[model samples]
Target: MTDVDLTADPLHDSPALREFFGDSYDRVARFAVMLADQGVLRGLIGPREVPRLWERHILNSAAVVPFLGEGTIVDIGSGAGLPGMVVAAMLPERSVVLVEPMERRTQWLFESAKECGIDNVTVVRGRAEEVDEVVEADVITARAVASIDKLVKWSAPLLSPSGEMVLLKGRSAGDELERGKYVLRKHGLVGSVHEAPTLEGLEATTVVRLQRQG
Candidate 1:
């Protein structure tokens, strides 16, 4: 799989996404290539994910960029750098920290950033709940990491007073929000769901935005 051909895969590339990424296109492309080549071998992504890496993962990750604010970001459970690395690549000026508990995954993040020439990111090896070094992030993001309640609980302490969470979710986002209402109130936060459309053909991503209530 070392010589993986991205063009051969279904839905591997998109011009809209290229323009969407703009100046950061090359870095994001290289990162995708790396993921296609080594993601499964490293146990970061499954073999089935390679073909749909562009549409399902990379493009899906890009959906959160518009909703992000200025300053530092913390991505919880950045397994294979889906949204974290993608965010870093798209927003070179904003600082992104990829927080993962697994040792191998951390190493993979380090390598991916280094090899892709993305210097604005920091790879931190720890769970989001226990990692005290990263604090006051302007925005925190998590993709397929946990339930809505757990995501809020883990992200609460790391967010700045006015910070918010922009989580990537599936069709069950609404349900998750309903289920996490207690936690949202407990944390003095409110939740809303937004539809973030990517390319013309693909399905829009469901984004759950959680912010502290005034």
Candidate 2:
């Protein structure tokens, strides 16, 4: 994993973030700043584990915003609501659900969403595999959740027939894709991987898009 610069200013002002992301940009930036200022994220995962507010967390999360359609999104294992909360803050038109199994983390997610003033988000306290019946989402996202194979199994049922699964992964994404080929084929899913440039200049990050095969 690339070491994010904690001291440097990663998230810019509301106007700048808004200009970059449009209307909801300010809310997203505010949320990131609030997380840092309130020490919610740091308290949950320590200061060392928290990513840079703007670069690693906000922008990294926003990179996938373009791929999501104007439908519901379900984020599995939304620890600290990384991309889930960020996505909700950025795109209020779409409904965002953060699925977390841990009670403490779920509580933190709701608190963060409220503090961020994001009304489009909902917190579901349950594991991905157990709550598929209730969550029929157009897009399923998982960041640092599980391996590709396992994540596919967990997210499959929640996805709409035309839905896609987007997984945030690091350098070993290709390896994971290769390892998951058999499973993907068995599940009638085909995957295409896209690499997003990281601010840290370390290993490139990948956003894997998996769609159901006909």
Candidate 3:
């Protein structure tokens, strides 16, 4: 008998995911398939990530969709387009810009957006701090990109007057927030952490929201 790897079928759909994604389910699912197939080869996501692509990467990325209010969204260091492309897929009406430094990664993003039929996506190849001044963002998002302090510094310039940074963080979110308090204050920003929901069984995503001090 041959052993079958269930993880190989990462796009196993669930009621919660279908309900959450609604009309955008097909596109997001296609994107996931692409990642599972080419993510490691393109050096975007590690091979180990393929097993839990839906829970860890796709659904976790979708957690940010609720908090994203009106206007353009800019995702920094959007390797494999985690929340960036995911967000674009879910919210087809909203403009989502993916900023990635590597040329190959940028190509992946562009190709994924095109092949997945995500029309609201724009791929920009540049470091977060070096992105063009014309690209003003109403909401900025990033996942596993950098420390809180560094993220704030890199995202500050691109933010619009009332823009906020909602970053996907991990268990050390609070500690990072504490350490970054000074830098946040220096940038005239304030930070808070929230537990954003994905599916019922899976752990909630840690999101750190940073906005200018009013």
**How do the candidates rank by lDDT, highest first?**
1, 3, 2
- Name model 2 segments beyond 4 Å from true: 1-11, 14-18, 39-42, 49-51, 197-205
The worst-scoring run of ten residues by lDDT in candidate 1 lies at 1-10
Candidate 2 lDDT tens digits, 139-187: 9988878999999888788988888898888778889999999989987
C-alpha positional error of residue 196 in candidate 3 after TM-score superposition, expressed in Å: 0.8
**Highest lDDT scorer:** 1
List clashing residue pairs in candidate 3: none
Q: In model 1, where do residues sit more than 4 Å from their true spots?
A: 1-3
Reference-based lDDT, residue 25, model 1: 88
Off by over 4 Å in 3: 1-11
Top-down TM-score ranking:
1, 3, 2
Give the Cα lDDT of each candidate.
Answer: 0.88, 0.78, 0.87
Model 2 lDDT-worst window of ten: 1-10
Predictions: Cα RMSD each:
1.5, 4.3, 3.0
- Reference-based lDDT, residue 162, model 1: 86
**How big is the positional error of residue 108 in model 3, measured in Å on the Cα after superposition?**
0.3
Per-residue lDDT tens digits for candidate 1, residues 1-214, read: 3435577666555666667777988899899999988887899888888777888899999999999977798899999997999999999999998999999999999999999999999888888888866546889999999999998888788988788999999999999999999999999999999999988878999999998898
